[model samples]
Target chain A: MSKDYNNFDYLSVSVKSDQLSRILQCYRVLGWTEVKTEDDKRYYDMSYVRLRRPHKIPNKDRLQYLQVRMESAINSLVEIVGRAHVKSTAVISVLVIIFLVCTGLAAWQFLSLNQAYSQVYGWICAVVACASALAACIAGACLRRRERRAAADKISARLKLMQSLIAEAKLLVPQPQNEEEERAGEVNNG
Target chain B: MDKSSRASHSLEDRSRRRRQRFTEDKLVKIRTEHSAGSFKTIFAALIILFQLGIIILLGTLPAFALWWYLLILAAISIITAFSVLSSHRAAQAKAVWVLFVLVFFFGGFIIYFMSNDKYMYARARRRHRAIFARSEKFLPEYAALNAAPDMKLTCSYLSRAGKFAAYNNTKLQYFPSGAQLFDDVIEKLKSARSFVFIEYYAVSDGVLLNRIWDILKQKAEEGVDVRLIYDDVGSRAFSRGMRKKMRDSGVQVKVFNRLISWFTFAMNYRDHRKIIVIDGCIAYTGGSNIADEYVNEKHMHGYWKDTGIRLEGEAVDAMTLFFLRQWEFITKKSFDYSPYFGHYQTLYSPYVVAPYVGGPEYELTICKSVFESVINSARQKLYIMTPYFIPDDSVVQSLINKALAGVDVRIILPSVPDKYYVYLVTRDNAEKLIKYGVKIYYLRDSFVHSKLVLTESCAVVGTVNFDMRSFYQQFENGILTDDKNVVAAVAADFERTFPDCDHPASAAKNGLARAVAIALLRFISPLM
Candidate 1:
């Protein structure tokens, strides 16, 4: 018969509100108790959830499993960070609208001057059109860059915490699935 | 039990019963609101019929004055729309929107001209967009604003000059605790000449509140036009006896958007502003409400930390305007409040002070814009202190971007949480921010309720918390200043109140609590 493992430890993580509930749900899905908070615990000391490893498994086994679990979670967050690089649809739409408006206005003016069709006026129209399009493109790029930076920053904050939590979990638990650990097994887990 | 112990227990019992009664009343009120909403179809039918009747009845009037009829109908509809928007009655809001949108669609130029005022805020925003286009150095364009010395100067100037008179002669004093704040408010009320206006989110039954009431009564007895407005929900703890005494002493008391007014539909919001404007020359605002704990007379969670500011210049005019505007709204009285502005000081100083208000009624959110601007503009450091740190996407984006851009961003939250669930949210944000380039600290052993944002050159402190409700829903007011002293004082407060932070390396106990909080927050995350 296997010896029962009773002396279980906890992993406490402070998460952003947006991600806290989801992380807690994740812990629950992993067969840990739902994150239950204390009445007096304020966030100044930093409170979100205390993720506990499920019991019955050997401590060594639990640690290895949790390490893998945490790594995957970290990877998902990293994926978000990777995908956070996005162009601003609003800026792009605005640019397209401006381009159309400027071109349409210039074309209409060109049509109105069809009979007069002076070479100087034609040259002036061409110059104005090129200048307007260039300016729009430049401004649009700047706006796109700014939006990208903001989105990156937001995603990175989430990514940073995920990395930190993984590190914290690593410090708390033992190494995962190494050849030495496989030989040691339940003895080391105890 | 001894007589005193029994008496205290009896008092507790009475308060408990009172609380239950209030809860029951609130339930009944909500049910009634829902019932009223069910009759919207009938109500709409009646309104349309009556409107048609009026058209037919007034059709006999001169053809030239036909526009006037539509104008009157439009005015009535606008009021109805505003009421529905403010109403706690949910169905009325949707109906009003539908009705108005329909009118705009089918109504010719006559109906359009008559009802266009319904979209005044939207139209005004569009117009102001063009105007603001000319002035690119707004509060939101921080990077562009900080790029050059000349641009930075222009930014400060523009910040001061937005939608209000830019006060140069203003002298602002910071009161770090409720002791100084309440004492100063009392002193200002005592010196009231023409009138005294007070508005607050919460007015609890306490020694500090009694002191405030006494001061208001004395001023009212001396013929000061004392007008007071308090939030109905927030001020529910106030004993009825105190209110009666105030009225008996001749102080005009009114509640802002009571439950009965919930039918006005905009009832989701409470007036979160804590403003005391005296004689139109002096004003006070901050996060502190009328309570003993606010001043640390009686501690609930821990030491209660708060902040307030006193203004004495053109900034007062802005506050006076805010008070008067709200007064007219709540009381439905159309008195010329111009007399209050008469007392504003004319002395010019170098301090550029801009005081502004934000609410759902405005097309542009002033508080959000200002915070975004300061966050965007932070070159060296960004210091923020708020109890609730639930920021919307834009704010989060700006904060993260600023920190990533090498700005030293620091935030302070309370170690002692007043609300556990909200505290959870705050922590969640804090952890993420800490992981980012931001350093998050807790104000050790105290609940810090000061809503402030301070940069190297600019500072803002007032009722606007860095939360969704304050930014998007509630009526909030604050003062923006490039004054060296105010900025320095704000920074000093931040330096003094850095709370003990729990490092991520530390083991957290109580999985149940975190799990429970997570579960509850998950269901209500969208609402939050």
Candidate 2:
């Protein structure tokens, strides 16, 4: 049999300080609170981040409640990422449209310059316009690529965090439910 | 088509031979024990199994009363305890007394083992996540260094080899013998500015160590943070006064593990790693320990051959971390690691040096994984040098596979036995492995105390012995480098040493008594 679900009241994990900060952001958004922070002398690179669930949770149904919290939080993350993904896609599409518009204007300018022996100042203006537009197009493409990568990384990290939380829940949750324990939780809830 | 048919025929022959030999080996049980306790042994095993079955049944029962379950458990536990203790009555008096001692006897060991594993596992999982995502936002340089997407390192992220981060432009200077190694160590000690971390398995009070002691004392007096860690069993002759003397001179001293008695597995796991990091940037590690014999000044074995490496660059950060971890383990106090950082200056050298450290604190032996990779990747040449050659089954099969795939497999062992019983076990492996196309050579010039593994691509040199102890029990560390010069140096050493060795006659010529003795010895090779 697995360990009694009641044994796990909190979680302590080792991570870099920066990572702990990001993880803390997620937990606080989920209504969880930081209960402790520890840095063992030996592991300077890794610091222990301890978190506690807000509000008092009784022994029974702790696993069930925690599981609910994790599922809800995971859904929230998925929604957040979905919105962010859509936002990024829209931004990239806008950039691409701008790029195409700028490229067309530059092509038109180049064609006119090719057809007519124009004033030196007009010719300089056309060349500068083409150069700046090309620059913007390249910058937009690079930014789009980078933003996509960042979005993917954020989603992956959050999913991994949720997976770990669910594993902890599984360890705490007993396969067979206790009727007495369920009644006790109901009483506490009432 | 003809070549493919020949290959098929060879494969069939190898499979047939393997089956035949394994069948014979399984059936041939050496009957060394008397027939008196056979029935008792069988009954005891059965009792243990039956108890396990009962516990599982009770544990999985459908919503049973907790009180009744407790009662049943107590009754059965008492009954089984009495039965088991009855058999061990010759070693104990009262069954209750036996039970009390039993609860606490292995408690310390069990707790240490479990907590250490959990702690390491937690750390490994974090690193694994970082690796899985290839996200440098969390650990940028560390992740990049260890992330070998191009290298065929099919090692688990939990293992040392897998978790290792390779550093570039690290200077790797090879020391072919102990003479150069010791001399260069003192030179680096002379240049020590901030800290000196030294750990060795065998640190005898001899000519070499005394000279090292004088240098260490001078450095300590000069205000260097000199810390020394030595194994309790390997350096048993290390006097309390010597330790006190080092302490008095401002040199910090820590012993690896204390022995409860002369005959006990209490201190079975040892700190066999030989590491010396001066100022955190310059480090040295290899098979040669601190003793006169290692330097060949004392004639225990004539011209004792060993190897060491002088590494300089970012890779020393890994070595320094290894030392600091050991220091923390022994001292039970965390040392400030900030002072050791930013001191290393990475130069422009083309070497990928990765430090691989493993011990009994972890079950996944990184050194063994490394050896398997080296053997599996070898296409042209595979050379090995060790005093002992008692390999486990996986290593044996890997070697066989490589040899059949046309890889030149050569291993050098000591003709002069520093350990006779261990030599017997090594002989056991040699006798078996040689039949499958692996060449075994005896180093007749002297005892080779070096631990080396070299392939066509890379080489591993450090303190890992080719036995179960080094792979599974003791703490070991080595450098896996694809540096061309370093691999060439190791190969050249093997080339020079091959002339001094002679291939033994085939194991088919061994007598029945010798064969039986080898089998019995290999059975308990782990304890040895």
Model 2 scores what on Cα lDDT? 0.65
Q: Model 2, range B85-198, lDDT digits (tens) per residue?
A: 554221222333335434433222222233233343455434434332442121115332333342335323323333556667678998877766987897778888889999
Give the per-residue Cα lDDT of candidate 2 at B378.
83
After aligning candidate 1 to the native by TM-score, how far in Å is the CA of B267 from where it should be?
2.2
**DockQ for each of the predicted structures, in order?**
0.01, 0.00
**Using TM-score as the measure, which candidate wins?**
2
Query: Residue-wise lDDT of candidate 1 within B101-158, one digit each (tens)?
Result: 3464223223323333244335434543443343332222222211334324444544
Q: Which ten residues in a row have the lowest lDDT in candidate 2 chain B?
A: B25-34
